[model samples]
Target: MRDLTKGGKDRTIFIGKSLMTFLKGHFERYQEIKKQLGHEFNPNDLIFFNSRGDYLKLRELHRAYKNAIKRAGLKNARFHDLRHSHASILLKKNVHPKVVSEQLGHAKSSITLEIYSHVAPSLQEDAAHAFDEE
Candidate 1:
């Protein structure tokens, strides 16, 4: 069982159009698979399942993520880094820090800044130019 303190938090992530379409198709297929399973299915089904159609374990998810990066020839990093990347991308676009922190499930903006400050270019811009004499 997941520790409620760690796993019970809710966060919202933006869905791109392509990802939405993909999720729609995935759920359609999921429904079909559920029908094939008939009454054997449980009500608490998982979004991602193992080959035996059981809920996926976290270790399985981590293993697959590691292998995917290896196959793609990318530098390996913790999956947590992806959350930072997403926040950084949003912050770079001048999206609000509170919004980004919420999306990243951070308790505060300080935590977001601590984790993703390097990726946030907002701090690097020279606002001094706004009132410079010609």
Candidate 2:
């Protein structure tokens, strides 16, 4: 809803089909719960909300994230790590950096490449193999 952190512009972050399906089911359940409470669901309302139907405060969200991480037996990981992981996975899968940058709402593709430069060696190897095949 708000402008991106770095770019200060609104952009769409496309989701994969599985995520889309999951979101659709979640929305349906939300609507049903609202109906049970004798309230109409607002499509524009935040997808995730606290029990009182408000956006979660940053600290509350962070606390929940930390608990989940601990329960999963992960250490030294923050919610932001998921974003970096997503970008790294895409780069390693040979997705174009420009596309990943757009998805990440980076000011430029170079920023994505700069941050995930460690993925470059694998990409270079893939390129070499592709060239050999050709």
Candidate 3:
């Protein structure tokens, strides 16, 4: 869940099945390691855990973000850029601004337009043909 505004707006993002499966597998492997340490398994444990079965910290989250981008060879990208990437892809697909705004949990559709609604070259070509006479 995410708080979209100071008080007025609210939105929640439901994770997809693929992400849930990946997290579930990670949790099970983490529990196996904990069992080797003679610790009890807690099914309600967090998504990321430390060696002592403690919840992971924000620093660790940042490290993983940075590491994954580096490993992916996205040398010029930042972790925050992935959200922009998602929005850009959606916009290029001709998805409506209102729908994209909700997915992004933005309080204003104008913000989505301001950021991502500009026509990229490929999408511009698609738009040109969309209304072409048969």
Candidate 4:
């Protein structure tokens, strides 16, 4: 409902086909639940919501995230760490930093590079090896 932080524009995050397939199934289940409850389906309804079809409060979201982390046997990770992890994975896989920056809604690609500079040394080595291969 609000503009994106860096660009003050609507941001779009493209999902993979697998995720789209899973979301399609999830939406069908939601529709079935609404039908059984005799509730009119509102397309504008939040995709993830409480049993009452209300958006979750911040505390509720945090609690659910904590529970998920515990179930996954992960420690010392905040929800925001997922963002950092995603960017780190993409950068390590040789995705352009500028593209990752835009995906992350960073004000500048430099910000993305600065934050993920730990991945740069391996990238530099990879580039050097590529030239040797050629």
TM-score of each: 0.71, 0.85, 0.72, 0.87
For each candidate in the order shown, give its overall lDDT on alpha carbons.
Answer: 0.75, 0.86, 0.75, 0.87
Report the C-alpha lDDT of model 3 over 49-72, residue by residue, as the tens digit.
Answer: 655566667888788888888898
Say which candidate scores most in TM-score. 4
Question: 1-134, model 4: which lDDT tens digit per residue?
Answer: 66466557777788889999999999999888888866554435779887667778889899999999999998968999999999999998999998999899887999999999999999999899989998
The lDDT, on a scale of 0 to 1, for candidate 1 is 0.75
User: Ten residues in a row with the worst lDDT in model 1?
Assistant: 125-134
Candidate 4: RMSD to truth = 2.0
Q: Indicate the residue-level lDDT of 131 in model 2.
A: 100
Q: Count the backbone clashes (under 3 Å) in each candidate.
A: 0, 0, 0, 0
Off by over 4 Å in 4: 1-3, 40-44
Cα-based RMSD of the predictions, in order? Answer: 3.8, 2.5, 3.4, 2.0
- Per-residue lDDT for 34-113 in model 2, tens only? 77755534434779876666678898899899999999998869799999999999999999999999998887899899
**Candidates ranked, most accurate by TM-score first:** 4, 2, 3, 1
* Model 2 steric clash pairs: none
Off by over 4 Å in 3: 1-10, 38-44, 118-122
